[model samples]
Target chain A: MNARGRIPGIRNQHQVLFYALSTCIWCKRTREFLEANNIAFDFVYVDLLSGTEREAVVEQVRRWNPSVSFPTLVIDGCRAIIGYRPEEIQEALGL
Target chain B: MSEIPREKVEALYQRLYEEAEASGYHLNPDKEFTLGLVESLLINEARYGYWACPCRLATGEKQKDLDIICPCDYRDADLLEWGACYCGLYVSEEVLRGERPLQSIPERRPPEGQRPQEQPARAPAVSVTELPLPVWRCRVCGYLCAREQPPAVCPICKAKRDRFERFL
Candidate 1:
């Protein structure tokens, strides 16, 4: 999905994006697999955001995952699938 | 093969700053070093290719232990060790082989006034089924046994095969 629409009910409006460290092979593989499966997603480079820009994303991750890890998939709204497990991602997004 | 581009650096810096703000913490410059290291690893991989994952340490000794004779630091008993990655994910042959039970390492540092010891806790009644067959782990450095137990010599550190232990 394009990065234009907002998640209904969320105060700050921004489309869900895949938050990832750009150079990780697992991250790349996850992205490629998602794309290959025709799963629409926008990538947010965690390495490219400013201090204030990533505030919400980080909070959401902490609230879900036990740790701050790369290749975290934030979908629809607050739901997150941390790390790159193809099976988990498939099940999460219903791919 | 080339220096990190200004754009990449700026983007990385901005992202780290955002993460710090989001996480309610400051970013450490050492993170830049870690990023650089990973970047270089990626570049090298792209240029050359995938290499078999090399064992870092054999038994309890460094790889260089092969060059000199030794009392054979390798273990002949059952023991378990745990280590974690910067991302707080556990890294161990045990986990890779699916021998480890599900557990999460805490991300936050312990509160002030209490310093936890460095030892990692072991799982209860560790299933021997989960341990990999000791084909190549060094007795000296605890490196994974890639092939036959204790190769004629640890190709990584040159420790003789006699130094390896059977964890399986």
Candidate 2:
């Protein structure tokens, strides 16, 4: 679940990594949206991780975007989308 | 963290209900969920000595987190614009009445760098009997207490220490 992988048929060939909190309603909605669209994505529940592991993951996210908000979507390892913006996610993923 | 007694939490909830009624504000309609959040606030107060938002990570630097205390500075605006606060513990009247659906609210607290920097200051200690204690008011429930400092948790509203403002 930690390693990035390819999602077949995604137009941009961008690997998607979802950082989310297990208890966050918005994160759950975002996951449902992706699933409903038949989009293949990998997600990590940040809250479920151990303290040290969570800190490392959060640091990684901070390096990309300082807000460190929930439901952050990393595209192709470089482009990061903060929050659950469905329109933005669609535009970024070309879905 | 020490476990907070259920009775304490219930007392706080009752106070919150009264305060909200007086202020024309509405708590979340989901009673069980609201109770859970209040319980979390109590736990955080016990653990951290302040009632930090249970949903957001606190850096443990009071100055840096002045905006994110439970009943955060953004709650009123959030309720006005989005029908609910960031944590949905507080909601607009329409949402309480089921006239409006609660929607996801974008984070309103400014990012770390954009937040106002804390100014440094110091106050000399005074004898408790010599000076009147500062009065702190809970923004959420309007509970007022006169003490040298705000309580770790609002006994009435369960709002965090930072949610208190000096009234006198």
* Highest-TM-score candidate: 2
Candidate number of the best lDDT: 2
Per-residue lDDT of B64 in model 1: 29
Candidate 1 vs. true structure, TM-score: 0.38
Model 1 misses residue B23 by how many Å? 36
* CA deviation > 4 Å runs, candidate 1: A1-16, B1-168
Clashing pairs in 2: none
Instruction: Chain A TM-score per model, please list them.
Output: 0.69, 0.82
Report every candidate's CA lDDT: 0.43, 0.70
Residues A24-88, candidate 2, lDDT per residue (tens digit)? 55665677777777677777766456668778988987887676767788888878877667888
Could you give candidate 1's per-residue lDDT for residues A12-53 as a string of tens digits?
233346766544445555777776766666676553344666
Worst 10 residues of 2 chain A by lDDT: A1-10
What is the lDDT, from 0 to 100, of the residue B113 in candidate 1?
Answer: 30
